[model samples]
Target: MIVHSFPPIIDSGCRMLVLGSMPGAASLQAHRYYWNPRNYMWRILYALFGDGREPDEAYEERLAFALRSGVALWDTIASCERKGSLDSEIRQAIPNDIPGLLADYPNVRAIVCNGSKSLAELTKHFGDHPEVRSRELIRMPSTSPIPTRDYRGLEDRLEVWKKLLEL
Candidate 1:
């Protein structure tokens, strides 16, 4: 079973949380979030915060930059059975304790779901709960290299993700 080993990079200062469906193969192999060179999650963040300098090249620095900027990274699935890294292949998925984290981080003003699966999981866990439904849920395109008909490249996807760090 593949499990999310990356702990939530959240603190009381966290104003936004970006949730991915789960770590892709490269990320899980490297024990880092968004490890794939083609993944634009880091590149988008760098553009928004680091002035377009290379950020993912330094693993720890990238994470620090996220936390320092009041953004946190995590996955919706705590563990799952999947032959590959694709979310479509995921099975027996166990969701993370998003409600608990939301309660712990009262400073969180918004939740930016990085993909459709992440948003669906949150809706599954907290759809009827007033506390969770109250917050703004900004669903952005997945940063995975997996291409969809709507978004072809990072630039197309980056424009949609800009609101995640637009504090």
Candidate 2:
């Protein structure tokens, strides 16, 4: 199966860009980033910036919240062939035009990769680009529901994700 990333959720005021490797099956079907309820991305964001409540269920509201927090969302892979939602399954990945987006949005001062895969892809494709190198680059643990040895609990992940507040 082939998957394609959505257009960036961004604005001129955005100072941080969050990049995922690609949308999972649920996100693709729902036409929204991190649509999977099990994903920790929304929860983490809400906890960090919202009024200590659960994230709004509406997609537009979530985007608005991110933008208001000076954050943007995108993916490293524009398109790829994959059997499942796992980044490990992706093949022949084509990177998104990150440099072009950075050129257009000069206010974006930091790029945050949601997982190892996103960081690896970003480095592979844009490591040398001035637009990428000149800004802060961060790699956070994957917010996917899948468990990892290092980041098994939401609190553990949240602890690291809290760094975004400092940026």
Candidate 3:
């Protein structure tokens, strides 16, 4: 089935752009990013910022915190055909116009990919785009509940994500 991406959550003050490969079925259905209960993205964000608000708060609070923290959420694939919510099953992916996004948000100091799929998509298309290459690019583990041998646990992933918050 074809999956469409959400419009980015960004503002003029955004200094970090967080990119995912695509929204999962749960996120799309909820019309919210990282809505899965098992997903660690929200937990990771709260830990990084010490936001005080619980991770499982209302969607509006999460969105407000991200915007206030100068972090923008978006996805690398504008649209794609994917089975279920697995990034591995994505096909016919159309890349988002990231260069244009960079131009539009001049304060962005870093571009952080939420997982391998998003990193590959960005590198394949915009790796050499002057504006893209100019920013600090980082690749972090996916926040999906699926276990990966490399990441021992949420702690392991948070260690990597801690550096993202500092950037």
Candidate 4:
């Protein structure tokens, strides 16, 4: 099993936090969120921001934009054991200290789970907490390539995410 190395990166100005189940191989290797070419995160954000921007922009640039726009990216699990990079194969999942992270970033008001796995883990672990109960839970499509086998394109998957930006 590979060791989970990165700590969550959150913005003090983040009004919304997007949580995924765990990082995939590309992300872990790049030490950045959505590092895989197939990951739709960058594309979706570029669509939200406007076209002239290429999805190939630097990772820091993308992260800076999200931080400036009050959006934070992280994962639900602090650590987990998996033989491979697939989120679907993650075993011995342990929910991270989300409340502590939220407390550190006081501006966060809504929590958006990247998919059902994250939502399920969050609910399973912290659903009873007062802060968790108060936060808005958004269930959006997973950006992992694994999910696309059963779903449509990123544009279709990101429809709910666009609506989320309105909030």
The top-ranked prediction according to lDDT is 2
Deviation in Å, model 4, residue 89 alpha carbon: 0.9
Give stretches of model 1 more than 4 Å off: 165-167
The model with the greater lDDT, 1 or 3, is 3
lDDT of 4 by residue, 21-126 (tens): 8888778888888888888877777777545367646777888877776778888887888866776688888878898888787778899998888898899999
Look at candidate 3 and tell me the lDDT of residue 98. Answer: 92
lDDT of 2: 0.95
Better of 1 and 2 by TM-score: 2
Worst 10 residues of 1 by lDDT: 1-10
Each prediction's TM-score against the native? Answer: 0.93, 0.98, 0.96, 0.90
The lDDT for every candidate, in the order shown, is: 0.84, 0.95, 0.90, 0.79
Rank candidates, TM-score, best first.
2, 3, 1, 4
Ranking by lDDT: 2, 3, 1, 4
Candidate 1, residues 1-167, lDDT tens digits: the string is 65564778888888888999888888888998888898989988888878778775688888889988888888888888877688888888888888888888888888899989989887887777665776788899998877899999889898888776565
The local distance difference test score of model 4 is: 0.79
What is the C-alpha local distance difference test score of candidate 3? 0.90
Summarize candidate 2's per-residue lDDT along 26-133 as a digit string, tens digits: 999999999998999999999998967899978999999999989899999999999879999999999999999999999999999999999999999999999999
Worst 10 residues of 3 by lDDT: 48-57
